[model samples]
Target: MTDESLVRACQTGDREAFSALYDRYIKKIYTYVYYKTHHKETAEDLTAKTFIKALEHIDSCDPDQRFGAWLYRIARNTVIDHYRTARPALEIDDAWDIPDTSDIARDADARQRLAAVRAEVQALPSVQRDILMLRLWEGLSYQEIAQIVQKSEGHCKVIFSRAIRQLRAANALAAFLIILYATHSI
Candidate 1:
């Protein structure tokens, strides 16, 4: 079912509809949260809380608003709140989403490259990092990111561009591979 139809159904207490929405977004939401928390259990906990909160406030959702965008907004707020109450989050691990290789040298090289990229990306200003993550990792559109970040679509594009440029300027190879890994389009 379309997200609009599913959302309407969910708002009207259709548990099945809500489940569909949950299933559609679970992985993307988990990835975004996991990248932020860097702890599997904490990411899982936050992901559940985000969904529960969404169910509680489904009525307030605009049927026309992109459901993914709304869902991400909730997830973002949940992460922010957790950080406020919790200790400083550790930097995201380099191999957080990397698949292991049988070739030890290749695996070591990949991890080292990923670590270099991660350090630079993590060093970016928060807004830039968020823009990069949503655009690249989450595969969200500029419009969806703008909605979630409360920025204009044009501004979102500019931020993403600047982020890419910053990474490239730091180290071309790491930046290239990081961008490649982060994006499906490129």
Candidate 2:
């Protein structure tokens, strides 16, 4: 069923409809949260909180609004609140069990570059960074980003265009996945 149909069913108290909605959005929401926090456990917790809050307030949701937009707004606010409430309350273990020493030097260099690029992206203004995250990471369309960020589609396109230009100018082409596409060394 369409999200709208599911939403209407949910409004009418259909458990199955709510379940479908949760299934549809959970991964995307988790990915969005993970990219922000860079911690698996926190992302999972926030994703759960987002859906719980969504369920709590679903009745007040406007059926005319895009479901993804509404859900993401909740997620964004939740993240903001989490940051406000506490600062790194927990340390998540990210140790890898497998010892993949196939290319230790190359892997370390790649990780350093990735960290630098992430730092650059984070330095961008919130909207530009969000546009890049929603577009590049989540593979969300400009229209979807427009709704999620509450901006005009044209404005979102412009912001995305500028973000790419900025990244390229700053030699952060690693983020643009130019590993093999670049003709000259970046």
TM, every model: 0.76, 0.78
Q: List pairs with backbone clashes in candidate 2.
A: none
lDDT of 1: 0.77
- Give the root-mean-square deviation of each candidate in angstroms: 7.3, 7.4
Question: Using TM-score as the measure, which candidate wins?
Answer: 2
Off by over 4 Å in 1: 88-114, 172-186
Off by over 4 Å in 2: 87-113, 172-186
| Residue 157 Cα positional deviation in candidate 2, in Å, after optimal superposition | 1.2
lDDT of 1 by residue, 1-186 (tens): 899999999888899999999999999888888766655777788899999999999999998988888998898888777765543453323223223342212234434555656666656776787888788877878988999888999999998999888877887676567777886645
Top model number, lDDT: 1
Model 2's alpha-carbon lDDT is: 0.75
Please write out the lDDT profile of model 2 over residues 1-186, one tens digit for every residue: 988889899999999999999999999898887666555677788899999999999998888889999999898778767755653563321111112332212234434545657555654666787789898878899999999989999999999898888877787556466757667664
